[model samples]
Target: MDVLIVGGGLVGASLAIALERLDLRVGLLEATPPGALPAVFDERNLSFAEATVNALTALGVMQKLRAPTGAIARIHISRRGDFGRGLLEASRYGRDEFGRVVVARDFGEALEARLADATRLVRHRPMRFLGFAESGDDVRAVRVADADGERVLHARLVVAADGTRSAVRDALGIGVEEHDYEQTLFVTRVRGSRPPDGTAYERLTDHGPTALLPRGDRHYGLIHAVARDQADAVASLDEAAFLARAQETFGWRAGRFLSCGPRSTHPAIRVVARQAIAPRAVLVGNAAQTIHPIGAQGFNLGLRDALTLAELIADARTIDAGADCGSDTLLQRYAARRREDRERTIGFSDGLARLTANDAPLLRPLRSLGLFAVDRVASAQSFLVGGAMGYRGDVPALCREVRA
Candidate 1:
């Protein structure tokens, strides 16, 4: 195997597809069998930046997705304190949309279909990775066990896409810096009287940042961040009571909230691994970093990780042909390429979360003024668009416009 990917979630599956596109032999080990996914789309709806959408489109997965679902053409961000509001419209940037929003399940299923069609990819289901040993010159042998028993699979590279609490990352003796915000994110889908009008809203309140992302059929994906202690009360509230509270916090931006689907909660934490790569091993997706959902950077950042690593691997193959490609030097180069973008994104998300989570009087005015200034400043708007598009530095070829 050229690359052994652990975990068959969205990130891992996408990584396999990306590598196979380069004509590389790839093997994926998944604890879950193929064609199995959660029944309904998770309450979460990921905001796909233009770069992410383009990358997925290039991979041929986007074509499988249902069309006319959820597209965010505008974004309205405001801090509830004294911070004034800032509105960003796609028209200003000469584009039709800032990004698109898709239900988690839909995106996963589409990627799974594409993976099924890739001839260079192999999948092992219901398998557990035991460990690995450095075998030949530049070959790492991995031990995996399934219902049939155990065996060793050797590969030039191993990618850990297992997720935030990554077992492979721990086996490599990598340490992560973790900050628990001590908050719980309550997520649900709400049907309202008025349509979203292609606008997403982020309201930073004293409790936490509440985001209402536009969804199909006059529904919105609602997320309210609150302290852990207060989560039970909010979750236990009746429909009317919950709607009232949501109305109070979010106002009538999408008109009155009529009903809500099942509610779910997740603890908020910001995690960054000290290192993303080791000799013969590279961590991608949540295994490398996990950020608070304040700006919807969690999955988008992971997608960027997958695409960046794919680009590196493709470049190495072009240069070395049949030679061993996954060396320490290759891993180092990949790390260097990713370091700045990772640091900048983590800092931006953490700073935003902390700043909005508080209600300090002095800080309120400053935030408001900053928002006002950004609205009037073209440079600032461009910076925001660049960041949102996942082009922090040395933009990847696939992220740029497809040339003739």
Candidate 2:
């Protein structure tokens, strides 16, 4: 096989699909069976950046979604006690929306549907990746197990998309830099008295942030953050109590939170792999970096990792049919190209998570000033908009194009 992907979740599946146009054979290993859903594809609502939606649409993944997606036409940012606020309208940039929102489960289904049509793609389902059996100069042998038993699969390149605690990464002897923010994020769907008008609200406070994203069904995706110690108490709250607490944290901006769906909690942590490549293997998505969810940049950033790697592989093969896809030069190029975007995005989300959580008296003035500048300054808004739309450094070909 030219390439073997170790995780058939969101990013892994995307990478496989992105390479479908190339004349190389590809394989995907999924631990879950054909009908079982992986934990990664849960009830979480994902905010797909403009570039991400465009790339997915180009790859024919978005067209297969069986559900509707909500558009983010406007963004509102503010602090709890600050009188100043920052607002951005997509129309100001001559676009109808900055991005779209979709449920993670639905997006996973769309990926599966698209993968079904990949003529050159092979799938190994209910398969478990044991470890690397042998690492040769041009190819690597990976040990995998299934109902039939254990066997070795050789591929010129191995891409790890298992997740944050990736076993594949561990076997590759890669170390990760981890930071626990000591915060818990609770996510669910809610109905506000005032229906969503395409505006997404992000209210930051001392504890954490309260975010409300518009949904397609006249509802909103709510994300409430609190100190880790209070997670149990928050999760145990009744529906009425939860709605009341959500309203209190978010204020009356979106009117009262009348109803809410099931609540889910996640720890706010940042994980970054020390390196993106090892021998003939590479890491993408959460395996490369699992960042805070403050800006909803996790999956979008991961998708970019997938698309960029796919683009590089395609270019290399085009230049030479027998080009070594797992060559040291190719891996170095991938690492060099991905560094800027990875660092900036991880820093952006980590900085926000820490900055907003810090209630230091002196920093309050600085925070207020920063918000003021972003609100009043054109350049500041442009920078924010650019990052929000996923136009950061070394973009892939598919993400560079936008259509109405």
How many clashes (backbone atoms < 3 Å, residues ≥3 apart in a chain or on different chains) does model 2 have? 0
lDDT of each: 0.82, 0.91
Please tell me which predicted candidate would have the highest lDDT against the true structure.
Answer: 2
Give per-model TM-scores.
Answer: 0.95, 0.98
What lDDT does candidate 2 reach at residue 125? Answer: 96
Q: Give the per-residue lDDT digits (tens) of candidate 2, residues 1-404.
A: 99999999999999999998899889999999998767778778899999999999999999999988889999999999866889999999999999998888889999989998998999999999999985668898999999999999999999999999999999999999999989899989999899999999999988888999998878999999988999999889999999998898899988888899888899988999999999999999999999988888999999999998898888998899889888889999999999999999999999988998898888888888888988889999998999999999888889877754
Off by over 4 Å in 2: none
